[model samples]
Target: MVSRVLVPMDDSETAGRALRYALDVHSDAEITVYHVVGSPSMMMGSAVGLALEDDIETAATERAKPVFDRAHEVAAEYDTEIETQVGLGHPTRAIVARADDYDAIVMGCHGEHSENITRGFLVGNVAKTVFERSPIPVTTVR
Candidate 1:
């Protein structure tokens, strides 16, 4: 009897599929879509803008908009609305840190940038780490 399900999303096809899977499989549960913005980096990245913003929370929200929009579109297909949350720093840590608040976690097998050699090395496998570290059940969709 899972009453709450968390779906961590990125602007990736597999993330979208995980959202759909959660909606279809956990219809009775309250669904929350989470997007993590990279933490402020000295090198090149979106977080550099976050570091400069006077209102860092607002900046993070703005950065998460595209992914959240896609989540909304997916929810629309099921005639449901989803709550959204934004987090800072690494995806795996952000997601796993929040996992205790929900009954389960649903996410993509890997993120959009996981295929990129450079980012893959830098980010590692977010879903794998989240699955291993999460306090709740984790379901991964392809």
Candidate 2:
């Protein structure tokens, strides 16, 4: 019954695991691999430079290429093809905004930069926020 499934991914092993899980569990559903590029920060991070480009949308897409490439590689392991999407701004907000179009959301419990030695929590901010705010069912893979 689930015709559409959304799997948010990044350049992380856990995200790859989540994608594989979705493919195995919902093989019949259309899968969309989404990657969100964080918005520019005042601290002049790489994202800020990317946002300053002539075309911000294109910049975002280019930044997300690595993630999408990995997603495609993973999808190939399952002998399936998946649609890829790139979003800008906060990861949680971007994903939640599109959650309504899918039957469910599947993602990693933490991301590439999720290791917070200061906070002592394993869950990434994006995953935590999405898990809390998503209107649709969310499945988080460790």
Candidate 3:
């Protein structure tokens, strides 16, 4: 009876797998593939030194499109509507706030990052922070 499911991903391999899992398991459900961009204000006072908030948001959306497109392609057999949502703010807060809109929250067990960026679930701060305050069930992928 889960009519809607949200899959928040940075469009990485593991996330791709999670998206695949959702589509395969819940073909009849509506799926929202989401990506969160850290607020420009948060980018400020940080080491990233990325000043182009607008540019980042644009690029992020464009980048996320392909990921969702792939999901759409794979979900063709099912009745799934794949969408790309770009959230501007903290990742966990945005996700938690929107969690109730969907029947469930499905996401990668481990987040996605660049080759140079370190990646791990509980070992990293992103996963840790989300773990501390996730209101819904979170299934972490390996």
Query: In model 1, which regions exceed 4 Å deviation?
Result: 118-124
Residues 44-140 of candidate 2 have per-residue lDDT tens digits of: 4568877568888898898999999999988998899999999888889999999999999999988877744324766778888998999999999
lDDT (10s digit) by residue, model 3, range 34-130: 8776666634443143345457667656655766676677567565568668776677788887777877777765665531376432433454455
- For each candidate in turn, the TM-score is 0.91, 0.92, 0.71
| Candidate 2 pairs with clashing backbones | none
List, in order, the clash count of every candidate structure: 0, 0, 2
lDDT to native, each model = 0.88, 0.88, 0.67
Worst 10 residues of 1 by lDDT: 115-124
Q: What does each candidate score in C-alpha RMSD?
A: 2.8, 1.8, 3.8
lDDT of 3: 0.67
Name the TM-score of candidate 1. Answer: 0.91
Q: Report the Cα lDDT for residue 30, model 3.
A: 82
